[model samples]
Target: CIWALVITLLGYVLCSALNPKASLQYTFTPGHPFATGVEIDYLEPIEWLPQSHDQDRTLGAFWKYLAIVLSFAAARDWLMGASRQERRSGDGASRFPGDRMQWLLWTLAINAAAVSLVGMLQRLDGTQQLLWTFTNHINGGHGAFGPFPYRSSGAQYLNLMWPVTMGFWWVLRRRNVARRSTSHRSGGDPHVLLLVLAALTAAGVVVANSRGGFLLLVGLLVAVFVLMMLWSKRQVGFKLGVLAAMLAVLGVGGWLGGEALMARFRSEDIGSMSGRKLIYEDAARMAEDFAVLGSGAETFAPLYYFYRKKDPAWNGYVHDDYLETRITFGTVGFVIILLIFLAVWLVPFVGNGIPAPPEFFLLIGVAMVGILIHAKFDLPFQIYSIHHQFVLLCAVLTSLKWQRG
Candidate 1:
């Protein structure tokens, strides 16, 4: 079923790319009265070919999307496929390896921590370039975070990670407690490291000083805490410990970037919606113009030029991913994408039971929730690395087996 959805999506994109009728012809004259200096003299008649205004970009994006989807499928098959040892078990049961998941979680958490550390240090040093190398004149060094010229993007990345790291710690703690119950022995707690890493990652989100990121981080932490308290079989001490850790994360994050965060909140743009209203208004006009077949994939930037009201600058994205999708893919393509999301998120829960530990699923769910909500207010999905990570998480979630835990 997932494959069917994928095939349908790919087919649609290919049709859009191959549409003969969907073309844009224009002429550019320097110092023209037009804001873009290019005047569109003709728009090829729209047909039912899934045509895009910019076939070249749509084709390029299609290939990249196909590659990402295929690669994820291949990697998932390799990881979840039955091994010789599982076959020899003779019960016809198979599960994804718990140790492998743990390793992956650890690696991801450590990497996030390192990136957060770098971003925090960069903010402290007030360097005028990213990594003390590449200059970003638009945002300047203070506004940049880690390697991302846009601090909000960096914050979005960290927001997606810290929750997963916390989930890792929760899984480890649960397993450790289970072991202690059976063995009557207590060993060194390795889960502490995960907690620390999660804290650092959360702090990174705050230090980046993205308003949306900060709010989402707070919401995620609160949700995690509430879920842990309600679902965990552990004692009051463990719950207290978790609460303390969360508070520490908030405290440290505030200390690191509280001044900047507060100043942003106090700024006048806070009430002005950061000029998103104008972009959204223009984007809505574009969507109405191409309500059916859409202008085409990867065509929003160019098509927006026609609909732009106040801003003459090139707007790459609609800021709202859903709105942009509606403008680019049209209602039909948007529905197809929605079906794909439903399949990915719902399939795992449709069988005998959840394929993996419920707690792990909870964590992954939280991560997805963050990005999905962020997409409503920002372009997290438009960014390749962030989009890839989201897809990877979905693939991982679907590939898990109930018997694995």
Candidate 2:
């Protein structure tokens, strides 16, 4: 929690520094990133025009680098800390926090509580006062972003993660049923609470109506169930039942709310599938034009505008994060990213023999699949939400290596 808070604070500091004070005081009017419909005085508390050169992503990249370094250092310490003792005794000493999964579960519990509170705030504001006021400007619907001037999609993106964490808590709760039964009945089942939280998150997701969040949730459930069934040494009947239950809970629930959840798929709306496709194609075309290192980091909008002037119907931001990365950083950047992904997925499976920390790997795998799949539709990288999830994963991975040593 402290680490997450630090990272978030750093991110806001970076954002404040990079965004011009004039721009930060007012809401950024939507138009072409390159060309302007009207240059209004920038007096909003948060302006989003410079998103193609997102200060947030830059700040997050710095944190990612730090996390990678910290993970390595932790592993090193874990390995070396007990080596002398092992040599003397011929038996290795296990670390206190040997169960990385437990730590991850705890972290998710904290995240669930935080996100739930935020979701409640969003629900209260949206249903009561902000609905008509925000709708007047947003035109497409707006959920809730904290204090930012723009009606951001980022908060909704964070909300998507609530389900994954809630799921983790659910699994942990079930695992603890034996212990809990011996203790106190009134303690109530954690799994039941998690399920309720997941339901509430579903409601929030439906209200947010993020195409990326919706698609990602679908992909996460399918991937998790299939992976578990394929990998687990469990009965076929048991696996099938688990799969069915997951589908019923997530898929069926989503379907019941499909009217609002799938609203983005209906028109040329802001959060629609068709809109994202348009941005993706443009980003691809821009990448081709810039070639080598593409347009440089944070230069996508300027480059996009340069291209758009020739064609007046252009808008900024390729909604697809992969395409956006390719366009902003070129093939080299794209390849580097792909290799990082290959390491994360393949390293554990190959070296560790099924990844001992089941819950950690499960959440990572789910989130990876979720983000990568969702990025094809929405650029989640622009926000601080997804990066925080990665940080939690890194922390778990670090603690795991510590225990192994």
Best by TM-score: 1
Q: What tens digits encode model 1's per-residue C-alpha lDDT throughout 70-141? A: 877875665565556556664765543344455566778898899899999998998758888987754423
Candidate 1: clashing pairs of residues: 355-401
Model 2 residue runs over 4 Å out of place are 1-104, 120-167, 170-192, 226-259, 268-274, 309-316, 346-360, 398-405
How does each model score on TM-score?
0.89, 0.61
Q: List model 2 lDDT by residue over 119-162, tens digit each.
A: 44654455422422433223233444332212235334444465
What's the residue-level lDDT of 211 in candidate 1? 94
The predictions' CA RMSDs to the true structure, in order, are 3.6, 9.2
Q: After superposition, how far is residue 286 of candidate 2 from its true place, in Å?
A: 1.9
Compared with the true structure, all predictions reach lDDT values of 0.79, 0.49
Q: Where does the lowest 10-residue lDDT sum fall in candidate 2? A: 20-29
In candidate 2 the C-alpha lDDT for residue 191 amounts to 48
Ten residues in sequence with the least summed lDDT for candidate 1: 33-42
